[model samples]
Target: MIAVDPEEGRVRLSTAATEDRELWQFLKGLQKGEILSGTVASIESFGVFVALDDGPRHPVFSGVGFITFPELSWRRFEDPSEVVEVGQRVSCEFLQFDTRNGEARLSLRALQPDPFATFADDTEVGQTLSGRVTKLLPFGAFVQVADGIEGLVHLSELARTPVETPEEVVQVGDQVSIVVMEIDVERRRLLLSLRHA
Candidate 1:
């Protein structure tokens, strides 16, 4: 089931298990921290199962792995299956090894560099950064400062004009200028505003 192509990011699973024994042997050969590609076989309440894409037809899977539901605030896809379907291909970073059970802990979200880490290296409070609005919520909008890093401009900080819903003053996909008010490294939260602009 596992497959690999030059254009794809990592490992991928394009078919069902044709040789479970050989696939099992290949899965045992992989080491931790390896990047993998695969297809969505099935999703359960606990996690997602993916079949590998290389010869020998291995079975590699990824779990939500870190954090809980309330912390993510993901607005959509109440179920993991809703977001990743039965045939969709995915890429993940191998994190933990569990040879005893043949299950490895994988991460899809943490694959890329952390945004806060980069922002902290190059930015400071009172600085202004131009960014695009990625998501809108009642509290604020999430602005993408880089590929994975985002800053939030609260409703009260959107503008000097009276505020109601975050969307009323700012809409998603609008590129705006924002002043960095506070950089809470401990919390990984950036406080931003457009009032001065």
Candidate 2:
């Protein structure tokens, strides 16, 4: 029980694991950054559910662990299936206990190496790198510099001549040379210039 109004004869019950002493204790004992192994039980548009190999079963869900789509991988993907599938065995870092949802929030990407950091370590401003235009927008074009790393070339940086759109200079899948303008490792972003290429 969490709250109650004696005069109104109303009571509010909590769904926290506190009601299940063993589960509550287990959840409390968990520390962030701990690795947890589990099997993918179900996949949803928002996240994936995992049936933990060690924890007690969830009262309502098929799994007691959950991983958000962004936590599944460092690479950009259109769907969760691109990163993981149901029944796949996975080792994820425990992010936190989702008290509201009664599940352990996990991150599969945390256990993997960050491609951006590696790219940044080897790259410097003004260094030219060969890349393929992966996407084009009105403001700029997105170029894939590495396997999972993409850099943006703003319209003003596309060329010396004024351009209205990225398509005026480059199109998707077009291999192009670009100079690194900025590598914001903290923000995990890269700004490039086709004009200086």
Candidate 3:
């Protein structure tokens, strides 16, 4: 559809060709939770861009697909390249259609079994586990007990003696013994206690 204003000499175009319509229809048919295959178009610090095999070009960007850091893989990785490379074929679960941006939010991890689910099923509260300190914050430290599972050891749980920060007692890459204080399975959060361990 094209509209013109003779007085202002302005024009607007709103129609698509048959192929464009078909492409859009195909994109529209995709639903959340559906798995789709695509090639890795590029990798950025923030996310990975995919060129979907049967999807339309983004109305804005060069690609119509995207996968954020957390959605890239089941395991924790510092870089996207560790899990996928440019030109690699991948299967991802469609998360949602970003109508405003004309892109699909996809998750590569959805195709894999959740490590947390398995961890929770086999573990119980008060279980002592050995872990490596992966990160430290003002309030707590994140300890990786399993390949992809991390638990938080709050400042209060760090030691029997009072401490101002986690760094006072533990640093990154330190092997620590921690007790599982609480588990919120629905939320996928694990609370650990270094003092109790």
Candidate 4:
């Protein structure tokens, strides 16, 4: 029984398909790091739903597999479609069984190499590199230094002069030269500075 209300003589029994034997059987068969193939069932602002080729149909969701936006790819994208389209076949790494959502959390990026790791392996602090501005915020601007790699240039580092916003120095898509101020592999962060360039 999922819920009960004795005074009202009402009971919510386990009718959800996720509570069925098939779901448990599918989940039990899943192991983290295992590859799963599926078709993209739907794409939402939050994530993409995948219809696993081997799993039972989901109880409530459109598919039994789910991939969050970040897991879609290592590269940044403005829309989910930029990474995948509905009905497209894809292979993903099974992250875990998401009990709350009754779906398996999957990652498409896990099947690809991490560009940040390669960038860190070859790059160093004080190295000057050119990048295109990708986003502007009150605190900083994000610049794409390499494929699937971005670094933050804080407001203070945008210019030698005090600036109110990143727009004061750069705009989205502007090519700018920057110096590597820090590369924190532990935190997976890369800090850049235009002023020091």
Each candidate's clash count: 11, 0, 0, 0
lDDT of 4 by residue, 16-130 (tens): 7556678768977899999999999999767899999999998766788999998998887889999899999999999998765578999999999888888999999999999
lDDT by residue for model 3 (1-197), tens = 13467799887654332236545676678888998898998887667889898887754344568899999887878778899999999999999875544568899999999888999999999899999999999999999999989999999999999999999999999999999999888898999999998
Q: By the lDDT metric, which is better: model 1 or model 2? A: 2
TM-scores for the candidates:
0.52, 0.89, 0.82, 0.84
What is candidate 3's CA lDDT for residue 196? 96
- Writing each residue's lDDT as its tens digit, candidate 2 over 1-197 gives 33457899997766654456666666677899999999999997568999989998876566878999889999999989989989999999999987766789999999999999999999999999999999998899999999999999999999999999888888899999999999999999999999998
Q: Residue 95 of candidate 1: its Cα lDDT?
A: 66
Top candidate (TM-score):
2
Highest lDDT among the candidates is held by which one? Answer: 4
Quality of model 2 by C-alpha lDDT: 0.89
What C-alpha RMSD separates each model from the true structure? 10.4, 5.9, 7.0, 5.3
TM-score of model number 4: 0.84
Q: Candidate 3: which stretches are off by over 4 Å?
A: 1-20, 57-60
Regions of candidate 2 where Cα sits further than 4 Å from its true position: 1-19
Off by over 4 Å in 4: 1-15
Of 2 and 3, the candidate ahead on TM-score is: 2
Pick by lDDT: 1 or 3, better one: 3
